[model samples]
Target: MTNVLVCIKRVPETSGQILLSQDGQSIDARHVGYTLSAHDECAVEQAIQIARSTDGEATVLTVGNDDSLEQIRNALAVGCTAAVLVEADTENFGPADVAAAIADAVRSRETDATTYDLILVGNDAADTGDFQVGVRLAYALGRPVLTGIGTVEVQDGTVVARGKGPEGTEVFELSLPAVIAVQEGGVEPRYPSIPGRMKAKRTPVDMVTASVSPVGNGRAALRLPPSQPSVVEVLGEGPAAATAVVDLLYKLGVAT
Candidate 1:
């Protein structure tokens, strides 16, 4: 059986305009909605699939405040068998801090004889676009890590991962007890059923205090790029616009 742990982050939904805080230190999330990153969602689904196939268990973990518990419960509702919440002031937590906290939690579980056979995370943070956590976590745990992986499978105590490379698809095999940073588009995450949500509500979450101090990422401030102005062009009118549309499509290389 292969036990898996999936780490996720609650990020602001990017469908709407993203604004920075007045101090420019962080995102202004007061008016924004939050959800799991696409990559993290896929990673959670992969962990669930792996656990189900191996008749093991999948656990979800996150380093954040109480608001993060909603995300943990969502993962549990879909399929994760267990959940962990590492309480910390995530506003000041950087990639290194998150990795350290996760490493500490993993070590704590190891001390209790709860060994995870595989760990999964998003290739990068959706909000910050930082790509260091998985690699740093692997280094801290002394485990091999693969990033930007799209698919993962376990066989013979090893993980076979496939991802897109510069030329095309590339595959790698790594020993068990490894870390994988997943990208989106590998698998579709399942929606939580009503019963699943109810069951998840009753599942207990293991709460742990972050052992590391918050160290902000070395960015002085954040700046948003200037918005591009929109332009609208009107073709002719009625059937007369058909020729213009065809010509425009051909000019844009959309038509032969």
Candidate 2:
């Protein structure tokens, strides 16, 4: 049975307005909610599907502080059999630092004979938008890596990954023990059922200390794009508006 590992990240929920800190160094999440990246949600689902079909176990992992355990439990509620938490504050760490820590954890687990046959990661982080972790981790582990994959299936000791291209769907075949960076293809993530949630709440998560120190590059502060201005015009009032609407439609060639 193939063992699968899926990496998850806790980022500020992107469904609402995003606010930056005054220093512009990071996202101001004081009033915002937190959730896993959309692509990572697909990754988790993919891993679970693969493992379930093969009678294997699925492990969900994250590089963050104790608060990130919420995400781990969520993964468990869906289908992950277990979880690993690389305890640290990801707020101040960059992609390289996070990748190094994850690689360390993978090595540690392998040393204990908990080898993973497949690793899944999000194509990019929700908040930082960094896409280096999966590639870097694959490099560190000396494994084949694929990024921006939409669909994935394991068959006869090989993985078939598919992604959309400008022309059509592109497919790649790779052997076992490969790292794949997942994107939101056509796969829909599943929600936790009542029994699943209860089981997840009682599952124990393995927590470990950070093995790598965060190092700084020549990078500066983060910034957000300027908001677009909205324009509104008064057409008319009551029956008078019908004439204005008809004239506008005729001018736009929507009417003969």
Query: For model 1, which pairs clash?
Result: none
Q: How high is the CA lDDT of each candidate model?
A: 0.93, 0.90
Candidate 2, superposed: residue stretches over 4 Å from native? 217-219, 234-256
How far is 67's C-alpha from truth in model 1 (Å)?
0.4
Backbone clashes, candidate 2: 0
User: What C-alpha RMSD separates each model from the true structure?
Assistant: 2.1, 2.6
Each prediction's total of clashing residue pairs, residues at least 3 apart in sequence or on different chains, is 0, 0
lDDT by residue for model 2 (104-199), tens: 999999999888999999999887787998998999889999999999999988999999888899999999999999999748999999999999
Off by over 4 Å in 1: 236-240, 246-256
Give the per-residue lDDT of model 1 (tens digit) for 42-82.
99999999999998889999999999988999999999999
Which has the greatest lDDT? 1
TM-score of 2: 0.90
